[model samples]
Target: MNITWNKRQLELRERFREVATDLVAVGSDARDRDASFDRELWKELAAADFWRLQVPTGAGGLGKDGWDWLAAMEGLSLGARDLGFLMSVASHSGLIRLLLTAGTPEQQHRWLPGLTSGEVAATGSTEESGGSDIRGLSTRAVPTADGGFVLNGAKAHITNAPVADVVMLAARTDTEPGAFELSLFVTRTDVDGVGSGPGEDLLGLRTSPTGPIAFRDVRVDADAVIGGVGEGLTRLYNTLAYDRILFGIIVGSSLEAQLEPLVRQLETRHAFGAPLSAQQYMQEKVVSLTMAVEGSRALAYRSFGQLEDQHDGYSLSASVTKLFASTGLVGSGLDLVQAFGHSGYESGSAVERNLRDSVAFKIAAGTDEMQKKNIFNHVRRAYRSGELAPGSRGSGT
Candidate 1:
């Protein structure tokens, strides 16, 4: 928990914290009331190189190891109340990785600079009605007479739909199941037939600009296909592997951030003729929840290390981290709400916001159930393959 950062990372993390706190002060109320999108804050991040923190060095980015970047990101996420902003930044970070991983040199040179400079917004598209299930996305691309292609189908839950200029999108390029069947295409958001719906009325992260859009026969040149046709899944999967681990940091640290302030309140305020902290039962409850926070922090940091090491086992590591962190969040959140009695349960308090937001953590990036399922699948692939044991389910552990 006392891990020291090098001078460069320390400076970067402190700057992010200062700026993020300022942004929260300016944007939190507006976001809570109207689900406002912080265009100005996004511009500041771009100027500060926050968007390019994970980009390759050649792409004009800081290019820290993925884990180091997560550490920096968690520092910003700690005590952060702007749900929409955290989700937005995290989503864009994933898209940046997708571009850096799959873009050709020429393509990288042409687009990455703009991304790093904040001249454009970036996003990825792959979700369908079934929640971005790899095989369930039905977006399609047809060859054009001029060596380009026509894209059709809509993407729901597309993040940053309102402002993104470059999108890493996926679609069916052929009927086969080959790696080439599903290709990744980069499209200009300003292209013809590109339009977006309003953000949703969500229980949390409402400030995020989530929406749906139809391709409606959109056009793209031949050079837009990243890593060629049918390599979309590979590219997307690689980006999300890094993305999911960061998700644990964002979710875990934010919960910790929210709970810490409330704990101080409990320490100062009396509930039954004595300060909540003085009551044995309340002390026990707060310590118990603090233990959950410490565990979440440990797992989050551990997973980030695995990611930076380029561990082949990061997928499983991420799943375990997320599973532990999120389950702890649910428990810790309940403890937080119950501790304040009706005061915490009412609207307007930070605890209420954290409570709503924590519920959403059970589902974002990857759900608790999804993490367990992926862990089980990882076990099967890594251990149970070719084993002939009867009814033996391999443990992902």
Candidate 2:
């Protein structure tokens, strides 16, 4: 409940903000227009050790804790003002988190160096069946006689799939099953029988490379399995929770980035007989944006603390954070566009691009419906347990 960033966190935040503004934000518009992922910029961030913020020191990382990492990422998102690029960062961070959580020592030793050094990594979970319907995935991994497995499956609409150097894949492993049993595997994209499709042209987040990845009888040793056999569901959700938490953080910072432009527009733009700032409606829009920035960051920081402490309520908090952040971001995005009028609606304009990018927040980590379902389930449990009392500020934990 401290609710304040310490000096170390503040320093890291400002440092990353400067790095992102100098290296990534400069060409964000161009990257979005061309649907390009700037590998050079990505490398620059890696060189700056952005990915190592939360990694333990023994693991060849900076050994910073979760709060510090969150602060730095907040600055990165705010300064860069490129949700697409940050989306890619979220996906990559998920991979790093998964490895940190479930990877064996050898597994970590094999992957963490390259991963921490800027090698692009992805988690292949969503398939053609859709992200929400993970239970319906058909990707199969049949075990071999030599303590290995042959993987044959495809993941679609995966962030970083088109440009990933390594992938952590989830594949069905149960030969006889009513409910699917899945296992996670680490695979290199350059291996034989592995193929990646070209990036998809999307409505928003165009700077992130997102596409399909397929494994055709791709072979991996027993060591490739993450955590254990038939244990992917838990780990998958853990990684997802991390990503969902990230969306909340990104929403907070991205909205903060919009506030300045929104206020400037209202202050300068004129209509009728006076400046738009003279209008109460325009002032309300600014207030909405400010509220969203504060609300999302508060929820995100709370969820992050729970997650870092390994609290039981972490998952629920993450869901709530993502849901609220996505809703606020999209709503505020629309208000900003409306406040700026035609110029905001113009293609390539910051507000126009931001509004478009904000739409993906609802769909990316998990749909708004998914978060609602999670929240409802949590509430139902709390209600049944007589824990849903009035004036209780708990998150139904």
Candidate 3:
């Protein structure tokens, strides 16, 4: 697959880079230190149409598809240099992806405009008890005689929860013993019986607000159902697969942006009366980082291609990409910190922040263990059906 961007894509990326540097990067360090979320900066991004990059023209969005959106996000990652902020963006994009793929026309009309105009959105799937285990989720939405549902449960560790205007959430709609029956719903946070807690102080990605959302007899109209009732699992997983693809894209592009600075540091920093660049060990670090960047981008692009085509293997490809990209990012982040020595280790330094932020990639979207399980399950099914050859799953098609 040719990974080179066309001229327009390149230009879009550059434009977003400028936007990130000017609007998003400013006060990023302070925000990280204080664990703050800047609403104004979010609005700045909206004013620049950053959220519309991937929206379809028919949906009253900018007329670009997934490829163009990926290019714009690549630029944002390069220029922002703030992973916490990017994490927030990724979380918001998850909701957008769900709407674009599965939303009704009325849903899109009501939410898309606000979403593109800086009204914060969040996806509530991971519960305190369930994490990424959908079968374990307990939030319930019981149907009322009027055809509406009364939602009663809470979502924990949700991004943007503390300030979201709306949430796209999954809740149990059936309770047949030992069965998993869920439905997706969209609701305004300002409505009665909905509440959000204070943001949690985390080890990393502190700049992005992460918190809990609660629903106590929250009434939602029948129109709030997304995809359909009793049909949420498929749509949920599809959204998740898309999210994993995004993780690969974000990690790959962010690492590429760090490459030049790493090169400069190695060439200029002397140790043992010679430049660090002269040391084979140091050179190996650069080589590892370069490989990670390339590997991630290749898999990301391939999986995204499969997703756009609605290929049956998209889920498997997406899982592999997330597993590989997250591992590579955390490992390479440490390599960068080690390369810079004390300066890199200094608190509030860019490299140190990067190292901290990179840790979340392993745990968010889906954990590495979860990805492995998904990969195994998908490959086993294919192998059993005689659809895949012995070694072809790992062939990276």
The runs of at least 3 residues in candidate 1 whose Cα sits more than 4 Å from the true structure, single-residue gaps closed, are 1-4, 62-68, 119-128, 145-147, 177-180, 308-310, 382-397
| TM-score attained by model 2 | 0.96
Model 1 C-alpha lDDT per residue in residues 1-397, reported as the tens digit of each score? 2345677777767777776777654658667768777677778767866667777788777777654566568767763577567877777777666666667878887777877676545454546566636677788899998999999888877677766776767788885555347788877788897777666677876777777767888989998888877787766665666666666677666766666666787778886797788878777766766666676666666666655565666777777777777777677778778887888898877667766766766776667787898889977875657543666643322
**What are the TM-scores, per candidate, against the unseen true structure?**
0.87, 0.96, 0.96
Off-target runs (Cα >4 Å) in candidate 2 are 389-397
State the local distance difference test value for candidate 2. 0.89
Candidate 3 wrong stretches, greater than 4 Å: 390-397
Clashing pairs in 2: none
lDDT per residue, candidate 3, 1-397, as tens digits?
6778999999989999899988888899999999999999999899898888778777789978889988999889888888888888888888888888888888888789999998998898989996877888889999999999999999999989998999989999986877788899999999999999989999889899999999999999999999999989888888888889988888898898889999999999998999999999999999999988999988989998888878888998999999999999998999999999999999988899999999999998889999999999987887898768765554444
Deviation from native of the Cα of residue 252 in model 1, angstroms: 3.3
List pairs with backbone clashes in candidate 1.
Answer: 179-230, 180-230, 183-230
The 10-residue segment of model 2 with minimum total lDDT is 388-397
